[model samples]
Target: MLRVCFTAEDLLRVRFADEPAPMVELMLAVATLQRSEAVFGLWRRRMGRALTRSAGPLLELVPATGKGPLFLDPPIPGFDAGLEHVLSTPTALVRSELHRVHARDRAPSPWTRLLADRDRDSWQNLEHALRTAHTHIVAAPWERIRAGFDAERAWRTHLLAGQGIHAMLTGLAPTARWRETTLEFDSTDDVEVSLDGTGITVLPSVYWTGRPLVGRYAQGWFLVYPAVTPLPDIDDPTSTDTLAMLLGRTRATILEQLLRPRTGSDLVRDLGLAKSSVSEHTKALRAARLITAQRDGKAIWHSCTPLGLELLACLPESRGKPA
Candidate 1:
């Protein structure tokens, strides 16, 4: 079990990230290789083929079964930076971290030579592998996945306000709970972390599975746990037949368009449908509580609600159909 002790000051400093960081996603993608959950099976197969031998050094960064060193957790403050951010990790820190993790392992470390001298070529290969994996595995579904992350953040913020911090902490995962001044995590290992007053940043990750992961870095200590909800596979075809029978072609098309939030003009341009027709369809969807429309200044933005997303998940993507 892992227990984190927090002071009153730490509670005041606790916060959630507004968006998911790319570096966090990249590291979690590497960790996903060890998992066999159904949600990740498709991603795992694709990554298996994409990961090259050049990225061999990165595999040693995280252990296959136990807790990985804090070095794997780059202390990035925000989600703004891209792959370049990770590639810029200080050379000294990298070398020191590599030795720390490898020193404890019984097997020969493939990265010892490079870490010892901070070899330029070795770092170059690692960068290439991470960029390639990000492009092939994470880029396509990022928008939809990001939407899920944003929704979960919103829900947690509301929980903190309505029910208090204790509820919000326990709500993070099934194994997580709060007792007096300390937070407890159910895991195989026994560990204790005291956050004197540094507090902690909680990140909700779509790729992280199983128990929560904890690490400390230059910025501060933080925990990355699986989000409460998983993004639905927009391509799943389980109930497409039923959805088509209930909602007609045009309305079904409209719901599919809203898979990612779009403004009125966006739907008009993409669908090549008249403004009035799109308005009518949107009105019906809103009445059914399937989709929601929020006016921002002059333009109206539309997006699928939880119910709308569920219905769309049941239906297949719209193929070539007449406007």
Candidate 2:
């Protein structure tokens, strides 16, 4: 298991990422594209077309199983900034990190060894691989990705407010546990990292769904894990017309209950709906930008957005009281 040792001061300094780390996310997205899940099916096609001209470099770094070179996932904002970070890394460091990746993975070609040497032509090709992948997988869909990040941040903030830092840390992942100062997540690697008051940057990711990446980073220590969004792939079926009927009332009631941030468990109990049904309704509302969800442990806390509040105000049935 991965263990994070936190000092009292370190606990006080737990930080949330204000923005998406594009490079880190790009690496993770490439990993997801390697799988054949329906959600990633479209991207897989695009990736094949986009990277056909030059493929092995990025793939070699981002293996199907374990993580890629740590240098690739720099905690920098914007894609260009991440590229800049990689560009600025000492050539020796790049070679060393890639060598470690080669030890664990089997994606390297004879040409990729130039990357270990930081050869000029090899560096350009690697950058080309990154650009192609980003264009195909991350560009057009960035808004959805950004929204997910915002929702996760809001969720983590809510948890911090109600339960404080310790609860927030241990509650980050379902299996994560806090024992005194060390936070543990189930893993086979048995890695331990100490945070000697440098604190951590808790980064939520849209594509990474594996063990939490607990590592010593430029930001002292870092934790990047999959966002706990409610069925991120499920879209709401209640169309605008359908929402005008009984379905509208259900959504209206959901909006009302959400005025004060509420957990999924609260909604299941209050709305008297099956978990699957509630997920359907909330997923729809979220897609409409009428409501937003933040993770509070495994249960996500849903709350109405400004647009939802305006809509709720106009609905005569919902105007009077909180549901």
Candidate 3:
């Protein structure tokens, strides 16, 4: 089990005192899970077969909100009525819009057939059915393993990891706002602590499992931070350095191809490299802050860092002049 420790000071920074620390943490966890599901669903629809490898890991890590009855008493602040209403209501509006857009088109994808059907109720039912059927058997085992290890310690580690992933995707700093109290884990491992914008000493622990699982679970939390700012312009010179660092590619051709967002598989196909190699290179790039990966269902989409574009523009053409 992963347990999170937050300092009093950290809690103050984020103004989280209004709600109890535990409650706030749970809410954040739920939100992050929700976002992951949404992103994953999108990817499953878009990429289809190519998503097999990453989809298993992602689905194993994050499961959907279950089929419990919608809460009517004091409802969840923004999402009071429930997910059905939340998804169904907007879907009706979107279906109409799509119909208009495709009115002149001769053909559309098989999946788009539903959009053309124009039955909001049927579509909504289908959506809910798909969500319900979507299962990640691995997630249950992993969660069981994590919980059995060190409940509170595991929770905190997963939380931080999720926040870190969120930071990369949205380009927002992953921060933990917590109270300053030092909570020791049951284990004897030295509780190494770190601080972020929040006034909390994030206690790192290794009580339950090894580092690999910790790293994998932590990613769920890392991708949870909100995207607070617009993505930086890719063409700016200063951004190129950042991109090169993130993607680990100095070649002009590779850099140029990454300008438009593409899936890891697409990149592998185009570059004639093995998928594993592409994944490794991308991970390194992500670690260096040179590129960002956005999860879409089962596949990860990659794009150049803003700094990468600047580097591309500065490179001299074959004719010996900058393009």
Candidate 4:
């Protein structure tokens, strides 16, 4: 278990990410591809076609398990930054982080030795790998990815406002729980981190939805975890049915709930629908092209397509009236 100890002042200074970090997403995307976790099997399969030679070098950075190198200093470096900032990361910092990882992991490899030698080629190769991965994996679906980031931010904001910081931290993941002054995580490593009044930056990632990544970063300290919502995917087989066939209060309510991106679990809690029922309804809505689903980690995030929003806009004010 991982424990994050906080001072009284730290409690007042907690912050949420304003947006997703492109480099962070790229790293997690590479890790996910390497493992081919069942949750992201579909994404991996789709992205396989886009993989390039650059991806090979970066895969060495992420081990099959354990904390990978903190290449992006300040774990959550870019708040609302772009891809250019990531590519522009100083070579010196990249070399330093790789050395740290090599020292800790003690996993000897030609790539590690090259990076340790401060080989400019190795640094350039890492950057190129990130760039290539971003273009192929994240750039195309960025709109949906950003939406998931926004949704997670909003949800945390709500938790902060309604129940306070403790709620926000513990609610971050099912495994995260608070007990008195220490926040504990169901982690693979037995570690303890003290905030020491530095406060923590809580960043969200669409690609990493499993465990909370806790570390001391340049931006004070941080916890980078999967966003509450998943990146949006629009891959269900389209059907020839018209929206009118499924128009009703229930379907309309589902569309309304999707004004912002949400997940099957979110809908289950809000609408009090059975898991199977929610899944079936979403499938129908997706087939009608009124909603699109993006699978992130294990959760499938749902958002209304333009057509779905347009249909909602045309609906009458009556609660149960069909559009």
**What are the models' TM-scores?**
0.67, 0.71, 0.24, 0.68
Which residue runs of candidate 1 sit more than 4 Å off their true CA positions?
A: 53-57, 65-69, 75-85, 103-108, 231-323
Q: Candidate 4: lDDT of 223? A: 86
TM-score of model 3 (CA atoms): 0.24
Question: What value of lDDT does candidate 2 attain over all alpha carbons?
Answer: 0.71
Residue 210's lDDT within candidate 3 is 15
The lDDT per prediction is 0.67, 0.71, 0.34, 0.67
What is residue 161's positional error in candidate 4, in angstroms?
A: 0.4
lDDT of 2 by residue, 3-72 (tens): 9988999988899999888887788877766765454566567666777666546776787543778888
Candidate 3: count of backbone clashes, pairs at least 3 residues apart or interchain: 46
Better of 2 and 3 by TM-score: 2
Candidate 4 error regions (>4 Å): 64-66, 73-96, 103-106, 232-323
Give the per-residue lDDT digits (tens) of candidate 3, residues 51-87.
3443322222222321111110111212222333434
Model 1 C-alpha lDDT per residue in residues 1-323, reported as the tens digit of each score? 98989999999989887677666766776777766766567767766766756444556665554345454546463433555555666777767666666676434365546754767876676677666666654675676556656655765676687668887887676667778898998987798999899999988777665678777876688878776444333222233333432343466678878988999899889888899878876875775456899999999999998767865653345333423
Who is ahead in lDDT, 2 or 3? Answer: 2
Candidate 1 pairs with clashing backbones: none
